[model samples]
Target chain A: MRITIKDIAKRTGVSHSTVSRALGGNTLISEATTDCIRKVAQEMGYQPSAAARSLKTNQTKVIGVIVNSIDDPFFSEILFGIEDAAQQAGYSLFIAASQYDLIREQNIVQTMMEQRTDGVIICSSSFSADKGRQLLANGFPVVVVNYKANENFNYSIYHDDVDGSQQLTRHLLALGHKKIAYLGNSKSGRTSLDRLNGFKKEMRKAGVKINPAYIFEVEGSEPELGKDGLHYFMNLPDRPTAIMCFNDMLAIGFLHACQQACIRVPEDLSVTGFDNITLSAYTSPPLSTLDQPKYSIGNEAAQLLLELLGNKIENSNNTHKEKVLKGSLLVRNSTSAPLQNE
Target chain B: MRITIKDIAKRTGVSHSTVSRALGGNTLISEATTDCIRKVAQEMGYQPSAAARSLKTNQTKVIGVIVNSIDDPFFSEILFGIEDAAQQAGYSLFIAASQYDLIREQNIVQTMMEQRTDGVIICSSSFSADKGRQLLANGFPVVVVNYKANENFNYSIYHDDVDGSQQLTRHLLALGHKKIAYLGNSKSGRTSLDRLNGFKKEMRKAGVKINPAYIFEVEGSEPELGKDGLHYFMNLPDRPTAIMCFNDMLAIGFLHACQQACIRVPEDLSVTGFDNITLSAYTSPPLSTLDQPKYSIGNEAAQLLLELLGNKIENSNNTHKEKVLKGSLLVRNSTSAPLQNE
Candidate 1:
C-alpha cells in the first residue's frame, strides 16, 4: 500500500494535518519537528502524489513539447536545451511527435490539456496556430519555435534564415562565382522561400542574372535529395559553378555524390550548406555553412513559456512577442572562387 | 473557469450524476441522454482532468522514458519507435535524459514515481538497476534497454554487440587483412568491452596473432576520437592495414583524417565500424558497419512494459527476462585487401 500523510502521522503520534504541514516545510512548523517528520516519511518510503497536489493547486509542473520528428537532429538538439531548462525549473516534459499530421497534432494538444500540462512548446514548424486555438482560448500558455502558421502565436522563437542565406550567398559572390544556383527543399514551407529570397537579394546586389534552370527546389532536404540535385545540376547544358544547399544534410549528400563521381569540391564545383550541424564540421574538406543556434532557440522558447506561466492573464490580449536569433557564416574548404575560364 | 461535468449538467438540464455517468460511458445511462450530455460537454469545451480520473482509477496512462541523451541520433531513432507504440496505446511519454549522471537518473526516476507514471523504460545504459530498487520494491513496471549494470532487470531489450563486432572482424579477415586493430570507446562500459572481446575472439579463431599495441580504447566514440585514433595508428612503427571502430561516428572521423592526410581508402587502408547510423551511408567511400535494429528494440521494450503493466503481480520473482536482438553487416566501399607490397 502507498504511504500517506495519515500513515506517517499515525507512526509519529501526531495529527495528519501536522504531518502535512511538516512535510510541506510550512514556516509555522518547528524545524526540529519538520526534520523528524521528514525522516520518518523517508524511512517509510513516502511518495508524494503530483495528481493530488495538482488537483488543489492547479499546477502540474509539467511542460508539453510537440516536435515534427524526434529523429531529426535539428529538433533533437532543441529538445535537449528545453529539457535542460525545464529540468532545472522542476518541470517534467511530455514529449510527442506530430509526424507532420494535422489531426495527430490536435490530438497531442488535447492529451496534454487532459493531463493538465502547465504550458506547451510547439517545436514543429508545420503545426498550425489554428490547431492551438483551443489552448489559447482557454488561457493556456503556448510558445512556438520556428512556427510556419499564418496565425501569430503569443510567444515564438526562430532563427533568421534569410540573413543566414544572404551571408552564404555573399561569401560565394565575393569568391567571383557568377554561375551560382540555389537548391531548395519543397517541404520546408516558408523557410525555403525565405532562404531563396536571401540568395536572390545578394545575387541581385552582385549584378548576376541567375539562369532560370539553375534554381531547383526539390521535394525533401535529406542527403538523398541533395544527391539528386547534384545529378540534375551536373546534367544541365550550362551547369552552375557553385550550388547553395537548403541545409547541411543536403550539402553532405552533394559532397558524397561529388566524391563518388571524382569531382573535387571548390575545384570542379563549389558547394555550401545552412544549419552547421555537428556532422557538417566533420565532413571531408569540411562544409562552409550557416550556423543556427538551435540549442539557444529552444532555451529561449522554454524561458518565454516559463515567463508566461508565471504571469497568467485571464484575458487574452493577443499581443504576440517573438525573438529572432541571427546565424553566422562559417567559411570552410567547401567554397572557393570558380575557375578562371568560367 | 474550467468547464466541468457540473457545468455540462447545468447547460443540458440534467443532474451532475447523470452527466458524469454519460461522460464515463456507463451503460446505465440512456444512449440519447449520454449523446446529448457529451455534445453539450464538447460545445462547452469541457476538459476532463486526468488528475481527477487517475485519483479514482490509479492509472495515469503515462509512460516514463529515460535516455542518456536526446541529441544522439541512435537514441532519437529509438525514441521515435517508443513514441509510435505508446501513442497507439493512448499513452503519453515523459522523457528525461540522465546524460550519464547517476544522481540525475535517480532524481528522474523519483520524479516519475511522484508523477505516478504507470511504468518506466530506462534507455540509459549507465542507469544502474540498484537505483531502480525503489520502483521495483513498490511493484512499478520497469524496462531497461542496453542496461550496463551487473544486476539483471525483470525486463530488458538490447542489441547483440558482440556478434556484430565478430561479423565486422570476420569481414575484414576475409579480405586477407591480418594486421587489424580495434578502436574502442572507454566510456561505453560493457558495450565497448563486448565489441573489443568480439574482435579478439574472431582474430583468435582466424589463427591471427594479436598485437596488444594495436588495440586502443579511448575515452569517447565521436568522430574527433576517430580522427585521434587515425593519427595514433599512423605514427606507429608497425601500422595495421585495417582498423575496426567501436561505432560509425568514429569511423567517419577516421575517414575525414585519412582524406586530410592524402591516404587513399580501400587501396592503402581498410576500416570498419559498428552501428550503421544514417550518416554512415553518406560518408566518403561510404562505411562498412553493423546495423543495430534500434527502432525494433525500442518498440519491443515498450511492448514488454505494456505487458508487465497488464499483469501486476504482488510477489517479486527476481527471475529477470532479457531480449537480445542481432545486428547485420553492411559492406560498403570502406574495406579491401592490403596493398601488394605490404
Candidate 2:
C-alpha cells in the first residue's frame, strides 16, 4: 500500500531525488519534468491518504452553492432538489450566503477557487455575469439561477417570468379586473423585473391600463413588507380591485395586512402572488400564484454542473446550456371576480 | 522538501528499512522501535506531501452536520447559526439529511469517519445516544443537539423544551382559559413528550382539567396536518376553546383550517405554537410561540464541537457537558382569551 519515490523513479527512469522534487512542484524542477512525474504518479493509481486527498485529485467532487439566505423556504426547497441530484452524482454540497452582497459573493467565489471546487451553482442578483465570465475563462464552470447569464459565458437557468406573470395577469383580467396592481420586492432584481414585464404584456393585450397609483414596491425580504405595501394601495380612494404580487412571501404578508384591516380577500379585494412557495397553499383562502418548481430548478442546476464537471458539456456546440423552465399558474381562492361596487 | 525515510532512520540511529516498517505500523517491528521512530518523525517536523499528507495528520478540520431535513426552514435557520460559528472557527460545513432515519444517520457517520472529519454535530431524533456513545468511545467527538444524551457519554445540547412549553401554556392559562388542547407531532419523540409533560404540569397548576377528547397527536412533519387535526377538534360537542400546538408548522396549518372554516383566530379559538420559526409571525393572526433560538442552538452545538475537536473539553473533571438553554415567550396575535359564546 505504500508508494515510494523509488517506485516512480524506476518507472520514469529518473533519479529518485529528481522524482521527489518534480512531484513536490519544486521550482528548481522543470515544468515538463513535474508534469510528467505527476501524470505518472496519477496513472500508477497512487491513492493519497485521506488528509492528502486535497492535493492528489484537486477534485474534491464537491459543489459550492451560493444563495441569498437559507432561512427562506424558497432556497431550502431548491437545496432539497440540488441534494437529490448531487447525491445521485456522488457529490457533496457546501453552501455559503452572500446575503445579496456582491463583495461577499466574490469572496466566496474566490474561496471556492482556492479550495479547488469543481463548480458552483449560484442564485444571486448581485453576482454579475461578467464575474461569472471571468470564472468561466479560468476553466471553472458556473451556473447562475433565477437570473440569466450572458450567452457568452453560458450555464444559466431561470423561469420564463414574463410568461408566468402574463398568465397570472390574464387570469385576473379574464375575471373583469382592469385596475390590477403589482406588488413587487423593494430591491427589484432580474426575476422581479421579468415578472413585471410579463404582467404588463398581458395587461396591454387585454387593453387594461397599468395603474401607477396602485403599484407598491418596497424593500425587505420579510412578508411584512407586503402588509406595509397594502397601505399605499388601500389609500388610493379608487384602489385597484385586484393586486398581483412579486412572490408568495409578499402575498402572504398582504393577506395578513388585510386580515388586520378587517378586509375580506377576493370579496373586498382580489390578490395573486408568484412563486408558489410551500406556505402559500396553507395561507388563508389559499394563495393564487405561479408554481415555480424550485426543486426542479435546483436539480437542473446540479445536473448542469455535473455535466460541466464531467467534461460532457465542454467544447460542445452548445457552448452554454441555458434553460428557462416554464411555471404553471396555480389558481386558488385568493382570486375571484371583482365586486360590483369596485 | 522531500521527507525521506532515511532522514528519520538517521535521527533514530536505525536502518531506513526499519524506520519505514515502523511508520507503517508493521506488527513485526518492536513496539519500542516504532514508538522511537514516530516520536523522531514528529520532532523532525516531517510534513507529508499531498498523497502522503493523509498518513501524517488525522485532523481534517471539517465538521459533519447530520440533520433530519434541510427542506424545513427550521433546520435551515439552525444551519445558519452553525455556519456562523463554523466560519469564524475556519471550518467548512457539509450537511446530510437522514430524513429522520437512524440507519441512514449511522451510515453517514461512518462515511464521515472514512473522510476523517474532526467531529460531528447531530440533530436527529432517530439518532440514538447509545450510538453516539460508541462513537465517543472510538475517540470521535459527537455533539447531539435538541436531544439529550446520557451523562455517561457527554457533549449534548438541547432547548429546555419542557420549560419553553410550560411558559407558553401558562400564558394561555393566565388569559383565563381552562380547556386548552395540545397538538403534538405524530412521532412524539422525546422533545414532544417533554413538551407534553410541561403543558400538563402548567394545566395541573392552574387546576384545569385535562380533556382526552381535545388532545391530537399524530405522526408526520407536514404543516398541512394542522388542518387535518382541526377537523377532529371542531367535531367535538365540547371542544377545547384554545389550542397549543407542537410547533410553528402545525400551528400555521391549524390557523389555515380556521380561516377556511370561518373561525377567526383568537376571536373564535386562541392558538399557540412552539419553536417560533420565521414564518410564525407571517401567519394570519401571527402565532404566539415559544421563541426557540434555533440559531443559537446551532451556534452552541458547533462551538461545543470546536472545543471538543481542539481538545479543550478533554480530561476535565466534567467529562459530560450537557446544556439546556432557556427560551423566551413571544406573544403574537394567535392567542387571546377564549370567547364567552364558545
In terms of DockQ, the best-performing candidate is 1
Per-residue lDDT tens digits for candidate 2, residues A29-66, read 88888889889987764433333555655666668888
**Model 1: lDDT of residue B251:** 88
Query: How high is the TM-score of chain A in model 2?
Result: 0.81
Model 2 lDDT tens row, B54-146: 346556557888887776777887887888898788776767787767765666665565456668888876566666665555556778888
Top candidate, metric lDDT: 1
Please, what are the lDDT tens digits per residue for candidate 1 over residues A150-175? 26676888888889999999999899
Alpha-carbon TM-score of each model against the true structure: 0.96, 0.82
The 0-to-1 C-alpha lDDT of every candidate, in the order given, reads: 0.86, 0.79
DockQ of each: 0.79, 0.29
Enumerate residue pairs that collide in model 1: none
